[model samples]
Target: MNIIDKTDEELLAIGTPWWEDLIKYSNKGQYGKFIQNFSTDLLRGLNEVEVGNQFAKSDLTRSLDTNYDFLGFIRRGEHVSFLFRVRSTKKPGEWLGRMVLGYERGEVKIFAASIF
Candidate 1:
């Protein structure tokens, strides 16, 4: 089935693993693994240098808590945006992590992702 056709619960199940990989690779500063499931357009816009710099400079990216809370999701056209409540292992307070998923080349891929 097409990814966008899935219900919120189904979509969350589908997206959780990908989101976990994002957090895992981000904490380890593994750019390749981090971008492995990114959409073509998203991959094209990223570079190892910038991503590495961000990983090095941001405490949040390097210290993400894996035990995150799945807040909910939003469906827009061909995309499903999942929201996560994330915390830093090395800091206080929480942050919002958003991962937007869509189909690319017949597979689910992350079209956009951010933490704030």
Candidate 2:
């Protein structure tokens, strides 16, 4: 399961361990880093809040409970993006996600998620 590419199969393969780690990592108070690496500034709301480590497992589970599926990727400039949609859900249908990445030296950070 590749975190950078974020394919459907990879998201599905994430399993429990990866999700647990992700929750811990984000809740540890690095949400800005997570946002900067996961979603791009091009979409909207790039930086308006502080990382307060407010992510909860219930919220994550609720978000993941949707039937939305990772369809594939679309390339735009330095970003490679993916789309997830849910038709049967009560919420809106159009939500977009992109992978934002930055590199310094050899340190790698992950900022990938479905921003809906």
Candidate 3:
């Protein structure tokens, strides 16, 4: 799916893999791979809050039980950002996620992911 000059369906397609890979990568403690989904600015922002540790902890602790929801989308100039609402049946809100799709380096990037 295209991020630049994308349709809504394209926007939808753009974020799914990143979310799935986020789970897979985080569970494996592949922090570099996990952060690769984001832009440098987003990475810097998340690090300031130590979210990677929380995400890794959640994934490593409950790798089998984690789940995510496609909550909705947000619009930005030249970007089609989507949100993923993550939940764990074990601890409903502990690892709640809000993720978005935006462009970085001329490609679609899963730019923001935060627990809520």
TM per candidate comes to 0.93, 0.35, 0.68
> Candidate 1's residue-wise lDDT over 7-53, tens digit each?
87778788999999999999998988898888999988988688899
How would you encode candidate 3's per-residue C-alpha lDDT over 50-83 as one tens digit per residue? Answer: 6555655664333523467677776766556566
Distance from true location, Cα of 107 in model 1, Å: 1.0
lDDT by residue (tens digit), candidate 2, 6-113: 554544443223333433454454454434433333326443342242343324323432344556555444434445443322343455433333222333233354
Kindly give the number of clashing pairs for every candidate: 0, 3, 0
Residue 77's lDDT in candidate 2: 48
The lDDT of each candidate is 0.90, 0.40, 0.64
TM-score winner between candidates 1 and 2: 1
lDDT-wise, the better of 1 and 3 is 1
Number of the top TM-score candidate: 1
Candidate 1's displacement at residue 69, Å, is 0.8
